[model samples]
Target chain A: AQSVTQPDIHITVSEGASLELRCNYSYGATPYLFWYVQSPGQGLQLLLKYFSGDTLVQGIKGFEAEFKRSQSSFNLRKPSVHWSDAAEYFCAVGARLEGSQGNLIFGKGTKLSVKP
Target chain B: SQTIHQWPATLVQPVGSPLSLECTVEGTSNPNLYWYRQAAGRGLQLLFYSVGIGQISSEVPQNLSASRPQDRQFILSSKKLLLSDSGFYLCAWSSRVHEQYFGPGTRLTVT
Candidate 1:
């Protein structure tokens, strides 16, 4: 079965420090990977996605993710952490449903804490 | 541009009360709609999806049910709410492409 795993349940980072959230996926074929961020009591916002032709994809809020096919990983990274960046991040992989429709399989998520 | 909207930003009801959550999309046509629930301290779980009007596919067997009466409208319903149903409900829409856009989400609290 196709699945996504976010190894870190919680991570703490100091302000202005670099941050990386690890994600690994298990799928049978070429996979579609995505990163999403969610604030408390709010909906998820798409961070970035890797479809094709690009190993590295840049997303909103100065976030970027690199899709490593060999490792079956798509990790999200930010150059410098901001206090407002403290939130939960989720990793998901697209899977085919009926016909051409598709759905996402999400990981448990990693909670990030930014320290001042 | 496409946008999804989920109503009743927050809901609170008794365990036996009937439940209804509505979602609608704008600026898109014949799009695929999905319903997902995010439990406390957990990731999003796919509940149901609709490829078109009156065509609903359930990903999990639970107390919840979904219907797509129109192309851009989807509804999640339950005959009776469960305490375990207390969580954030999200609605999303996607095109032929795999990427999906989410709504503001509705927080459901079943007491």
Candidate 2:
């Protein structure tokens, strides 16, 4: 079965510092990957997605992700972190079945804490 | 632009009570709809999905059920709420391209 793994359970970084969240996926073929962020008591927001194109994909909220097929990883990065950026991040892989797109499988998520 | 909406932002029900959570989408047609559950400290688990009106596929066997009465309306229901059913339920929509858009989600607590 296809699965997504987020190695870090929690990360603490200073405001204005760089941030990177690691994600690895196990899939049979070229996988469609995505990053989503969720604030406390809020819904998940799409950060970035990679279907097919340049390895690097940019998304809302100044976030970007690089899809490394060799590593089977799609890591999310931000040049500078903000207090508002503190939230839980999830990595997901889209499942396709019988020539149609299916649901998604998500990682457990990583919680980020921004220190001032 | 497409938008998804879920009602009853938060719900508290006793065990054995019935449940009905509604989700709807606007500005799109023939879009795929889904229902997911997020347990505390866990990832989102897909509960059900619908490809079109009256087409429902369940991913897991649980006390919950889903229905799509219209093209963009999805409903999650349960005859008897169980303590284990308490979780954050999310509704999402996706186009043929497979990029999902999520709603604000509904928090259900069964006591």
Candidate 3:
């Protein structure tokens, strides 16, 4: 079965420090990958997505992700962390339903804490 | 751009009470809709999805059901609420592409 894994349950980073959140996925076909961030009591916001083409995709809020097919990974990275960047991040793999629009299978999520 | 909306930001109900959560999408046409629930400290679980009006597919067998009476309107319902049903419910919409736009979400608490 296709699934997504966010290995880190929580990560803490200092302000202005580089950040990386790991994600791995298992799927039979070329996968559609995505990253989303959620603040407390708020809806999730899309960060980035990878369907085809370039392995490196840049998203909103100074976030970027690299899709490594060989490793079955799509890891999110940020050059510098901000206090406001603290939130829960989720990784999802899209799977088609009856050849129609696909559904997202999400990982358990990784919580990022930024310390000033 | 398209936007999704979910009503009753927070709800509190007694056990065995029925549930009705509404979701709607604006500035889009013929979009696909989905219903998801997130339990405390858990990942999002897909409950149901609809590709078109009156076409619903359930991903999990639970006490909840969903309906898409119109192109952009989706509803999640339950005849009897369970204590386990307390969670955050989110509604989302997407086009042919896989990227989905989520609504503000509704927090349901079944006491």
Candidate 4:
């Protein structure tokens, strides 16, 4: 079974500090990866995705992710954190499966707390 | 432009009450529709998905059911919701490319 794991349950950082949220996936093949953000009472928003080609993929809201096949990891990063960036982050992996188009397995989210 | 919509942004219902949540999409055809549930501060759990009308697949056995009677419309229903059913419900649509686009969620609270 393909699965996604986010080791950190919660993380706190200052508004001007750098940010990095870790994601590790267990998949047999080269998997499609994505980063999504969810705020309180809101839907999950796509941050970035990696299908093929470039290892580093940039997305909306000044977010970027790097796909490391050797590490089986795709980590989300930001040069400087903003207060608005405080939200729950989820890393997901998509793979083809029988009886379904494709399933997106998500990691246990990491809640980001940003301070002034 | 393509857009997905989920209704009843927030709802509070008794434990034995019925449930009906709706989702619709615009500007696409033969799109894949999905239902997902998120517990408080938790990741998304795939509930059900439909590749086309009348074709539903369940990821987990739960107190929920889904229906896609139209190409771009999906519904989630329950005979009686439990307190455990309180969470955020999201609907998503996608093309064959497999990149899903989500709608503003519905916060369901079953008392």
Q: Give the deviation of candidate 3 from the true structure as CA RMSD.
A: 1.2
Off by over 4 Å in 4: A96-100
The full ranking of all candidates by TM-score, starting with the best, is 2, 3, 1, 4
**Local accuracy of candidate 1 as per-residue lDDT tens digits, A1-116:** 87899999999999999999999999987678899999888888999988888799999999999999899999999999999999999999986444667788899999999999
Residue pairs in clash, model 3:
none
Q: Candidate 3 — which residues are off by over 4 angstroms?
A: A96-98
Residue A14 error for model 1, in Å? 0.6
Q: Give the true-contact fraction for every prediction, in order.
A: 0.72, 0.60, 0.70, 0.53
Candidate 1 lDDT over B86-110, as tens digits, reads 9999999989888889999999998
**How close is each model in CA RMSD to the real structure?**
1.3, 1.0, 1.2, 1.4
**Which of candidates 1 and 4 is the stronger one according to DockQ?**
1
Name every residue pair that clashes in candidate 2: none
Q: Rate the local accuracy (lDDT) of all candidates.
A: 0.92, 0.93, 0.94, 0.91
lDDT of 4 by residue, B16-95 (tens): 89999999999999999999998865778999999989999999998889999899999999998888999989999888
Q: Which candidate is the best by DockQ?
A: 3
Given candidate 3, what's the lDDT at residue A80? 99
The clash count of every prediction, one per candidate, is: 0, 0, 0, 0
Model 1: residue B8 alpha-carbon error in angstroms: 0.2
